[model samples]
Target: MQTHPPRSIQLVAIPLVLSTLAGCASPLQPQSSSELQRSMVLAIEREVDQAKAAPERRTLSLQTDLTKLEIRPDHLKIIEDEYSVDGYLAQLGALDTLDSPGLAELLGEDLLGQPTTMVPISLENAIHASTGNNLDVEIARYAPAISEAGVVQAQAAFDWTIFGEAQYQDSNTPQPGQALGGGSAAIVRNASQTTSGSVGVRKDLTSGGSVSITHDLNNNNVESSFFGATPVPNPARTTGVTAQVTQPLLRGFGSDTVLSEVRLARNAERGSVSTLRSQLIATTSDTERAYWNLVLRYKELVIRHKLLQRGIEVRDDIKARRVQDARQAQVADAVARVERRRGDLLTARTNLRIASDQLKSLLNDPNLPVGSEAVILPAHDGIEEELGFSLVEAISDAVTNRPELETALLTIDDATIRETVAKNLRKPRLDLIAQARLVGLADTFGNAYDDTDANRFVDDWILGVSFEQPIGNRAGEAGVRSARLDRMRSVVQYRRAVQGIVLDVKDALNRVFTNHTLIEQSTLSRVAQGEALRSLIVEKELTNAGYSIERLNLELNQQEALAAAELAEASALVAYNTSLVDLYEAMGTTLQRNRIDLVVPDANQLAAGESPMERAGDGQQAGEQDAEGDE
Candidate 1:
């Protein structure tokens, strides 16, 4: 009896064979955390590349679950899931792809009549989905509310005022005269009562930097002294009116002042809104990319499996040749057959595992069910590929639409507002005031009305202007200078953004064109490889030839060509999708109907601004660049 190596031993022999051919197969070997992270990143980039080819019309959900999180300036960690991204990439990291369905099942499903729908899930979607449940869009959107509230507060200083006052008091004490005369009761009751009310309207002078007001009022009072022999009538009543005004004459109105700050704040709020919109654009682009990654993975697995079956046929043919020729020993030929079969088997298994893992990660399903692998639906929707004139049109769209560039422009606007405020603070403090009042006093309420005359009313009025200047004004000047520099920086960044966008669009276009050529070349190579295999097979059958050698060689070559063809197709798909993604990103509207949320000072603050209803046909503004330019 002869014993062959156990399956486990054969599996062990895999690495030995791999090492002998082209170094060790260390796919399962432990990798450093950094290495794993790098691999993941590259994987993510590949997915993004694939997604750009296949755009999905996914609606950006208003509510994102980001329960797992840390909001450091440069990084985010999913405490629950053990996932994290460095702060440097967190905003952009949202564009990575998530896991998808298994390739085996998805392909089978496709064969079984259920075509798969392939969409690119952007990195933004993966980050958002995994951390979305905990993300409070409302919190981020809350900023505008606070800004508006600030406006209200700014105006409150000069709106309107209404005041009222009332007092009643009673006291019991011994009277000096009564105590000295040994009065029957040493306690005396004293009481007093008073009431007053007023209503006024106020206004602020924007040009003059002054305060003006007018008021109307009424007063009633009574004073009684019961400690004396008898209660004495002591009643006093008065009614008065007043008008007051104040103006600034120097530095206060010209430079450092509350009014200036209020104006700057309003501008800041507007810029914030623009910034938010930009963030949403970036997130949407990311989500779209991720969705397509799953599709590509599914496609690769199917192709690999097909190649594996071809390898099986080749192995059988090699074995038959060995049996047919007894004189020509076939040790080397048999070994090669075994190597090819093993290599194909290993490759097929590895691809299946990789595809499964990727799908699980994207779905945010770590504990994926035993059979719940990702399945890629056929993506044959046939998106109209942008060609020739469309390419030019797309370029124009991107320049006018990319959100990051637009956001950068808004940052410049924000800086300009700050500069304006800073410059305003450099003015001297100045103010002016004028007040007039009418007063009347009488022993009785009826007499008080009659005594109410300008002169008799104790007419009092005054007008004055005030001014102040800081000795050095160093702080004010420094602030203005700093703001000016910041404004300059913003402008530079804006220009850079525009340049970067133009370059990115052009580069993506070139890639698309290059892939077009590769697709054609790969197709030709596949044809040539097929002809070579057929020729070698015929040659071996026609004559008593050792042509099995040539047949085997052709088979290997054909295998390589087919693999290249598949890869080229994948690349072409990615390049095509990338062009579309770049076009939409430039246009600033990837998810036609639902727009994603942008990262802003307070994204939660703007929650109310984003409506849940689809705005596809709405007359809302599309891209910031065009809107701002028009404005």
Candidate 2:
């Protein structure tokens, strides 16, 4: 002690000694908490790398080469001969009188043959309406309440029960009696009348036991026919009160066995709630897509209308040229293009109508039905801003939020609870039976009860045990095995659901990326086509180029190209917006994105006349404050 090492040296030496001992005991030491977390992170990264190396991911990397071909403007001048001057004048005069019969026919009447009204709605309003009024959502809303009822039913097993029974009997018998003095026997008649009644209350306990208290009463009148024979208290009354308890010592013991049904029902209710959430997500996504589709169709109609007018102009130019040098085939070709453009316009109109009806169908609003003639016009345009996203974060959100995953997990819990009950049932049935009774006898019912209460009567006590085991226990063993398999199946199902959700998230994200790129490329193509059309028109007007079949064909092609490019650009934008909807849905965040909350009412609430479902933003919800003044 006097030669003790310095404090710093002592600490270093102690640590070294402990380290040496630990190394000698085990070559591999347990990791610290921080080290374990680092290892888990590295494992996740490796798994992500492996997933990215999949064939589908590789396919996404391959790109289509789209090279823009440049067109050089032709520098040519037409000599103004008398015939050309006459043709130019003729074209100028015919421009005003040109008529497109095909277009006129299309615009003359409604395609659906119904009076129509245009109702403009925004994306948020559409989603909100669908969540509130969609038939699918309404149908799913009942499931959670039904499952809650099942929970109530399961819990009802433990409620107290009251029972009562009363019976009366009369009997007469004739018997031969022998005298005690050894004389000849005489025929005798014995008659009795009895009244009995019992009343009790019983209740089951969570500990796999039952306790019952019963009160029993009996009154009897008897007569004996014998010489010099009499009975004391010929009419007798008896009252007995018993308290009994039967507790299972082995099979059916414990809360796990007694409350298994209640636990399973609760799990079912959770699953139903998830199902409702999934329905809401689906409805929101569908409504958004339908709304965007209506917008796309409306834009396409405008493009087609312009394309038809252009065709009419080209036809008029050719007809004017026919006054000088235009051939019959040239005019016919121009007319054919006009007819085609008109047909496209008609088709676009039909599509717009169909899209409007689809949106109405999803909304199912009282003012907007599928059979209604009202057309839904989108008040909001497609979102054009780029969305920033990370694949890792997206997958994480899907794992945390997807209703299918939640449902799968709840199912596993349900299976586990059942398995516990089955295993408990495999044990031999052993029960402890105990009972205590107090008996009282008196001439009057009130007096008998008074004696029973005062304990002025004989008391009886019973304590016993019961043991039962099925031979071979085959049924019990099979049940345990079945439950074990079911639990394993549920676990596998959960994994499958997780994989499916991940795949859906990835696919939707890919679509969003692809469509965003398409929007950029389509915009460029549209601009290029517009420029080409302008250059062609300017060159023709400045050069006074005489109309011929080849010239007419070039003009028609350019007009078609521009219209197609415009339509493609609009379609791409709409697709990108719809892709976003799909991504949010896949991530189970559609309702959150739309600022809508799904509320599933409980069974009691439903029974009290509350709605089965209420949307958070809907003004109709009870106790909801109206941001706008109430009507």
Candidate 3:
């Protein structure tokens, strides 16, 4: 008995020391409600999966106010009164309904008395499915296709064309337009018949030149009885082959002007690809954010459930004490905590439901039925992994890979091409024209063919130049000036895009670091609470005395601490994952991350210019800021 007193004091003091040490410790196990949620989610998921696996007489059953289905993100107290009795009753009823053979399960109870099956959906599966079915991504996917069609349309102007024409004319003139022939001065009737046919191919050159080759055949017969003309008994047939070309000598010459449309179209095509890339990255990032939000809410629900369970235990313990020892106020306090947590539990469940709906919307899973009764469950929980980030590297990567940055660069390329074309157009229009022809004249078709020989062919060739200038040319000057301004505008926009990307990367990195640190601090506080609760539990057990009020109060404190810890833990993980999403998107590497092979028309093949990925606007500024609005 003498040695037992020292041992008792040591045992009593041990928990206090451990509680102090726990303030620096880390957490391992998540709250009990997570397991509860996981089970509930699994059950619902399995049932939904079974429904998809085999067709059934599925029908809509549960109905609620879907318009106000979601609550605001604010955490303001929405319970009617300070101690809402109705709210408490409602939560209790809900809990009872969700229990073994509960209301939620019984409503859709199977005919054969089989359990509801649940399907487990992992995060990766959700992302993949979301990328495929997300409406935003679907809308963006068509942009690239449209851009490709535009490029094709722009290039079609330079294709070759075949043209042919045929005509026959018969005419007779009487005394009004008479001619004399055969030494007769008397007025005679004049008549003529002619047939002509031509076939040709014309092509537009990329150097702003045009070439055409044509072959013409004609047959004609004339009769006259006047001195002005002589009557011919036979018809004359003629055939000729001609080739013509027109080359620009001043304005609209060279690739800059000739291929301006094609170049601009190619830039536009690249911009479209980048735009789609941005959209897809945004979709996946949002999917991740919503997914993690679901994780946090689920964990919060678990914490609330545990708190209520603790409150129930404490309330019962206080009741047992009230009968033996006088502790009425403590009993009331325990009951109050229970009711408070009951309200919280209901809120948590509501939030959980809201999150589940959001995840379903993001994934767009076909198996998940539409309605309040349908549920989509998460297969994975929050996880914390050690990660590192470099600000310089992030900025560098973003400058080179950010979709917006690339788009801005493409815009500059487009502006530059247009500017060059506008400048070139300011010159006077001068074209060099040349043509070569082989002529044949004969009375018969065979004679005409024989005349096609090089020696007999008539070398009818022509060469000339044409020039035109707009008076004053104010329109041309203004167009050139506007194009220069456009190029400058694109430069400013690109610089601004780089700054925005850098800032975005910086913010994401900061969040990641901050959340990781919070994880450590939250885990420590949770450990401390667990130790304090343990100390109290041991103190109450050591004595045959009735329950200690302090021990009961400590349980409440421990419950609060546990809830905070779970929240911090889940929040930290969510923040980390969200940061990575931002980082990858800012770097324009999400396509690579998701293993998507985006197809974009090569700008380099279309023109000589640096790509948007290479620089901002007019030049490359690795680390610079500018003021410009997005187009």
List ranges where model 2 is wrong by over 4 Å: 1-115, 172-190, 223-232, 323-329, 454-460, 604-631
lDDT score for candidate 3 against the true structure? 0.61
Q: Write the per-residue lDDT of candidate 2 for residues 1-631, one digit (tens) a residue.
A: 0111111100012223223323433211122223322332343344345443432312122132333434332211121111121122233332112122332233334547644455556666677778887889888888999998899999999999999999999988888777657878787788889999999999999999999999999998887775424455557788999999999999999988899888888888888999999999998899988988987886676577778878999889888888777789878888988998899988987888889889888887765678876566665566664455656556656755789966875776676677788889999999999999999888888888888989998587899999999999999999999987896787677667767876898899889889988987886676567666766787787775635656777989998987888888888878988888888888788777777877887666655445533433344321111112122
Distance (Å) between predicted and true CA of 216, model 1?
Answer: 7.7
**Can you rank all candidates by lDDT, best first?**
2, 3, 1
Name the better of 1 and 2 by lDDT. 2
Worst 10 residues of 1 by lDDT: 1-10
Question: What lDDT is reached at residue 510 by model 2?
Answer: 88
Model 3, span 154-272: residue lDDT tens: 89988889999999999787664433465434555778888999999999999999999998898888866553364342588888889999999989889768988887787777788
Candidate 3 lDDT score at position 184: 38
- Deviation of model 1 at 66, angstroms: 52
Q: How does each model score on lDDT?
A: 0.47, 0.70, 0.61
Ranking by TM-score: 2, 3, 1
**Candidate 1 C-alpha error for residue 122, in Å:** 16
User: Residue 399 of candidate 2: its Cα lDDT?
Assistant: 59
**For model 1, how does the per-residue alpha-carbon lDDT over 1-631 read when each residue is reduced to its tens digit?**
0111111100012223223323323221122223322432343233234334543322211122322222332222221111111111122221122113442232343323564323222233333442221123323345565766676677676555554444444433344425546646445544445455555565666554544444333443333245444323355666666777766665445433445556556655664565545545454455445444544554455445555555666666665666664224444554565576566545654454455445434333222322443342222211224344233333344544555754564565566666666776687776777788877666665566566664487578787766776899998899999987886676567556655665676676566566555545543454344444445555667866634655565665666565556556555555555555654555555534233444344334335445321121243222212223323
